[model samples]
Target: MSEFVSQLSDSLYAVFQSETFVLLNTVDQESGGPTSSAISWVYAVDHSTLRLALDHRSRLVDNIKANPRVTVTVFGQDTIYAINGSATVTQDPLAEVPFKMCCFDVHIDAVRNALFYGAQLVAAPEYAKIYDKRAADKLDSQVFAAMKKA
Candidate 1:
């Protein structure tokens, strides 16, 4: 069995300092099932804390409100990690962004290595925004700036 660490390692913290491909998992309030969402506006506030932003109208808001426990799956440092944590809404509508954005604070509980034995990751996941480049860049810049602040 893989060992579970209590917080993000230094390498993971550095990886999360910038926007990256990640999966946010939450519990379904209706069916009591696990729900997952792909997210990029995730920032590591510290080794044990993270800050994330999403649209205020995103269903993830309701999911977190219903159940604070969440897991953020990230692929970095040649492996996959499940960052287990509890989350809470810190901001309803972020003032810096032109659009309404919701911010959440996640306090990490344990980080588990999710990769199977003998499997090696060749490359980290990458994504591209399909929208207007200028608009997307501006939005990401604003959102990340807000997330980085204490």
Candidate 2:
């Protein structure tokens, strides 16, 4: 991958790991056009593979099935990264669980970082709350225990 593509992938991974959402665009094969769709729910990311949770019936899915070409856009505080790649839909029962778990872990890590850095401005309120609660609960039960005891 080129530096720009690598940066875009890293930025996307960061955003997905935090927000669990992204703006996904796919190219229409027959018409050779682009269709933009908001995929706010992603299943996970393992290395370079980005697994998104989308309806099998949706146009975006259809578009992807027809043509694996896709572009994913992730927004940060001051920077936006666009990733161009190919996506393949998988229905493998055995791989499903692990893929979802990986995605969840990435999200958890993102939540922790966002809370730690006070970068909740770019996240949805409910998402921030969920992550904040997780962080608070973890700290309360572990690192912050000494302070509470003191």
Candidate 3:
């Protein structure tokens, strides 16, 4: 079993500053079932808090609104980190973005090193944008810049 900490490590924070593959889990309000979504626009605001931007109409927003409890599984720095937290919708149609987006602020409760015992990850996950490269890059730039701003 792995131990749990109250905040993210320096390595985890750095990785989240850029595009990284992470899985967000939330509870379905009506069914009480777990819902998981792959996301990349995640940023660590600090050791104990994180910010995520998603489409305003995405189901994840609805789930989070219904239940704030969430778990974000971060895959980077040669290990997997399961970060449990409670999230609040900080912004809808976040300012400075061309399209409608929602921002979520997550207060971390616990962080666990979920990598299997005695094993190390050889590589982290990678992804390619399926849409127009120029458009995607522009959108990401705008979103991340807004996220970093105070």
Best by TM-score: 1
RMSD (Cα, Å) of model 3: 1.3
lDDT of each: 0.88, 0.48, 0.88
lDDT of 1 by residue, 69-96 (tens): 9999999888899999999888877668
Error of 3 at 84 (Å): 0.4
The Cα error of candidate 2 at residue 19, in Å, is 3.3
lDDT of 3 by residue, 1-150 (tens): 788999988888888877887999999877889999999889999999999988877888888999999999988677888999999978876889988888999999999988989888888878899999999999889999987762
Q: Tell me the alpha-carbon RMSD of every candidate.
A: 1.2, 12.1, 1.3
Point out the worst 10-residue segment of candidate 1 by lDDT.
141-150
Q: lDDT (0-100) at residue 101 of candidate 1?
A: 82
Model 2: residues >4 Å from true position, as ranges? 1-3, 7-12, 92-150
- lDDT winner, 1 or 2: 1
Model 3 poorest 10 in a row by lDDT:
141-150
Residue pairs in collision within model 1: none
